[model samples]
Target: MNIWNLNLRHLRALTSIARLGSISAAAEAINLTQPAITQALAKLEIQLGQLLFERHANGMTATPAALLLAPRIERALAHIASQRVTMAQLRALIMLADHGSYATASTATALAQPSLHRAIGDLSVALKRELVDRRGKGIMLTDQGRRIVRTFRLARAELEAGLTELASLQGVETGRITVGAMPLARARLLPSAVSAFYRAYPDVRINIVEGSFQELIEPLRDGELDLMIGALRDPSPGADVLQQPLFADRPVVLGRVGHPLSLTSVTISDLALYPWTVPAPGAPLRVQWEKMFTDADVQLPNVPIECGSVITIRQILLESDFLTLLSPDQVAVELEAGWLTKIADTPEGLRRTIGITTRHGWRPTGMQNAFIQLLGEVAL
Candidate 1:
């Protein structure tokens, strides 16, 4: 179901009724008439197709559906943190923040530009804060606007999760999991887990977005991604993210199968003689590559190409004498095909932890948890 179709005020009324146990008390709490609160509850039940409350002689008793949903609704509202912000305002601002232009946001939402503009203007007035600023041909979100957008995204996630749980209760499994995958995870870990998960929940959709850690972190924080899988950073990426190590991966020096360095034993001095292709600066692989030279007391080698793409690096290695440090898993196919060979292990058996990263307090639905369990099983 499209959660945006439901009224935020009605959702608030539902939570209030669940807490207060009577229509009169709930209406008094949210400043609505008793009849209005009753209508809101009835409308919510009809929309959700579940009996939210059981009428009794003394008061209303919440059904299982309401028990599941009320806390989610309360948490979502806490993220919003504003009694004055309307659903229309939240939708408009989020669209503008995501698309970066009123015209594009209008096209995306199928709303008239004037309506979007009015909604944003009303939102700014209600919140008593500036959300957007005109810059050249477009507008940009203020810092406050970005913070609001993040919270709104999280709120939407909570509601979507609640709906997913409700659907599961009805024996209907539904929801999407967006995963941010770095190179190592893409090569084997993610594919194995996804295949196992699909066999169990065929109807759920899984989306894998491939990028470096720098590229995927923001989306993971903003609730655009369910989780990220890749090399774990040394000093946690931030206070808001949690990392779980699935396994340890040791990198190898890769070269063309017939390259000069393909000997059984290779030295750092031997490695320094060849031109290298490494990931861009700040990448975990690049850091390990640098440390290899430092530990051996050898000057860093000349890196002719700084790249993060395994395919590009593989093609270059096959065509020329460029060596790179990579997890063997990343080049397993090339090794099996005899297109590339591991020249040597990284110095001192340097290893990076491969794992999952997620928002610190994320609460995954049952399907999501099952997928995570599958990842652990596949790792084992």
Candidate 2:
């Protein structure tokens, strides 16, 4: 087997697709667009000289060829993960050689200058790969260095998890647990638990990336972030994802106080008659909303704007009769401020369980585990 033939991106993309089942699901899992994922898959298929998937009604499923290759791919992935730590060491060496005692920066930086250089040098020599060479620009990664960094990201994450695990066992706290979550959760759910976790483990760092549910899933699945919390939908059943329902969130229809429908005593049919800024199609809430309308013998109107942004929905509400359906958590500010009020006291068929997701068999680091535990503790 031309072991050098398999690159990290190829293996990861394949694994993601095999796990999730569709290119679209894999894209969501890894946070790439459908086009980018398709291209990656195409390239990997070409490199491997075999079709990896069979397109299906729900999504794609791995082919027998893919199944046969799984074990070898996994083994290679494991080796790449080990090589990555070594690669980090080499890159660190190169970085230090160039930056030279960058002690000029504040002491609290995540990676110090000296440690970076030594790590890089050690990695390069250990790999027997001249990842960098001194040139007029001081130093540059050789052709191999570029490839290593390009494809080794996931493996690097594995390396990091291993290192973090070891340090935790030694009772030497590592750093922050990074979480990728939608803006509403960041605002409402994370603050309290994160604050408490920080107080108890002062040395553990905490980081957050805020986006819509669609935006956060890829980061979480790719191991870039520890976990994500949002409306629990089955992870694109085809994308190899594992989800756990953490809490239930009520569905809400929202409008400014002055909106025409704000106090109209609207029935489900009344909702379908109005212009709406709906959540994008395929999302669980949107699907549920459509089903509710369909059940009431109404077709969900043509959505002029379909988005996942509560802020934008709120802005649309302020200017026009355009209305929105949101998770209760999302409209907390506007609701409390009296800018938006409910059309009804209760929204039937609008509530859903919020779920947390991670890679199927993926485990969390100590910090990640701490944050997730805290999130569950402070759930509404």
Candidate 3:
């Protein structure tokens, strides 16, 4: 409770144990040895006068004390993470306000580093103590620094929003547009959209990032990515956003050369029995695969392999009997090369939709509009 004497390493160790389930796992999470983790936990318990976890055969089980503390610990971490966004936003605001573009401060004062040093110096002087402990890699955030960052991000977002709104709207769609997408789409959807957009209006600068669908939701709400595109299975449209129906896309079953299925006119049932390579659960293709076998009255055999990339899946399928399911669009090359053969009568209803989405009040730039149109053309 005493911020002056609190040890962040100990707090981090306790958080790791709560998350990773054991002292050993916690050590792995924090890059420390098991004994170091054990020592940190012991030190924390001594400071707090409470046991946070119960050692168990299965794993470390959270005590009531730990369970109550978990949410607080996670909130603290979230606060720390927000500092990164805050710092970035603060720097961006300074550049936008002064030079019109991010490159204006290119000469110096990048990413708010100078501002941070000034703030730290001011604080150290005010407190009559040295706060920043700079190391070989980077300066570690003192507890006070962490607290400052947590609050700072909220204030920064508000300030940035106002600055963005007032800073003389350039092209159109005056607010931020954050997009979330998968890796394959990096080559497919992103570049096309960016090009189609810039061609129409050169001023619509977008902040685009790539990640899995699961990782995109929080950012969407945090006002990061404006929209998300990627194949998601069994998408439960949440109350705040509407998930419009996109087109059902085509999926093909793939097998390596010399697979028994390759020689056989593999039935859906036959395809289900072999060792399979598959997309991770929740991928659009994986969902289609599960639905296909079930629709044909077949139970899915154990899939021993997981592949996230279409190219990797194709190579594995061609080299061995590893049956992989892929979107036909993604595997046109493999099918043509004879490296992969369709093992089953590629089922219906396993197609992904190419669609555009926006938040309820989301505005689109000319570029965003042009790109969405182009996506429709390519997808259709």
Candidate 4:
């Protein structure tokens, strides 16, 4: 009666019943008898301690619990479809996805053509969808099949991570950490922290994903990223994400080493004299940049380029006299390398909180927690 002992057949039965809205229809979909479908539903309800459907004269109506549980069931199925799907099957699908042909997949996996097709057939059943379709001599994944493949890959990664965690607990050398890096952190804090982390855990793999706030936040919420390091947004970015402040960061004017403005003490008016590169509209940095100008009673200078790319900005600054406003940490390396020079700190003392943003209710694994501790040490 344990829910954990629930089998794929029972879950599929429930899914079919909920979708088709009848025990008879569900039975036909899975090729089981109506009475068998009813028995499966009854057993599932007992184990779940809730009614999944209300039996009616015409058909079965899904209960609220069934409605709520459907998506979770789909996600769970996507993660670990069934014991029926072996590694060989996943390997076949992966090869087929890449080569776009069963014959090619057979050659790559060293599996026979029939064996590969059979494995895919079993996988399609476990996923309750047609995964492959033949167009002349070629084969391709259905839309649902493609989605299943993506979700399955993520699930496989999670499973691998679990195994790696166990190995680490047993004193084995292995682990991986995925980090989402935003502009401010990428330039200094992240690199320093990563360097320190590597010295301690060289066996652990590190992946740094760089993107703007909007690009990274969704993935963090979806559990694709362990944590994000960057300029913390004001007003608490979202209720689902929690931000921790490590230090205060303020905007500084930066220009190439020999730019005219870098040679002299500059005021707000002097800044207005040059064309500039600034963050795109609606970005947090853009808001700060505009405020700095307005506070100085200086008309905003002409911006020939609006950008968020650190690489592009650095390149443009190196080649031209166009100035830019950026967090000091963001351009720390360039300044130290003598490729860029700071004009001055924002006179109004504008500041942004620099820190980590993680999904709410997320608990970091041991090594991940250790890495976060290292980030805190470096931040201080």
- Best candidate per lDDT, number? 1
lDDT of model number 1: 0.92
Q: Which sections of candidate 4 miss by over 4 Å?
A: 1-154, 235-237, 263-265
For model 1, how does the per-residue alpha-carbon lDDT over 283-376 read when each residue is reduced to its tens digit?
Answer: 8888899999998899999998999999999999999999999988899999999999989887666888899999998989889999999999
The sequence of per-residue lDDT tens digits that candidate 3 reaches over residues 174-197 is 444456766445545566766766
**What is candidate 3's TM-score against the reference?**
0.54
Candidate 3's C-alpha runs over 4 A off are 1-114, 117-179, 183-195, 198-208, 357-360
lDDT of 2 by residue, 1-380 (tens): 23224455556667788877788777777677888778877876776566778878888888766765554455437635542444345334333333433342213335766666566666766667877667764556677875555335445455456445545655767665777776456557777888889887888777778776778776665456777776777445435577777787777777778877774668777777778887778877788678777776777776898877777788888888776777666777878998888875334545777767676666566677777788888884
lDDT of 4 by residue, 267-295 (tens): 98999999999878877788888888899
- Per-candidate TM-score against the hidden true structure: 0.97, 0.62, 0.54, 0.63
The best candidate by TM-score is 1
Please state the error at residue 214 of candidate 1 in Å: 0.8
Steric clash pairs (candidate 1): none
Q: 2 or 3: which has the higher lDDT?
A: 2
User: Number of clashes in every candidate structure?
Assistant: 0, 18, 9, 0
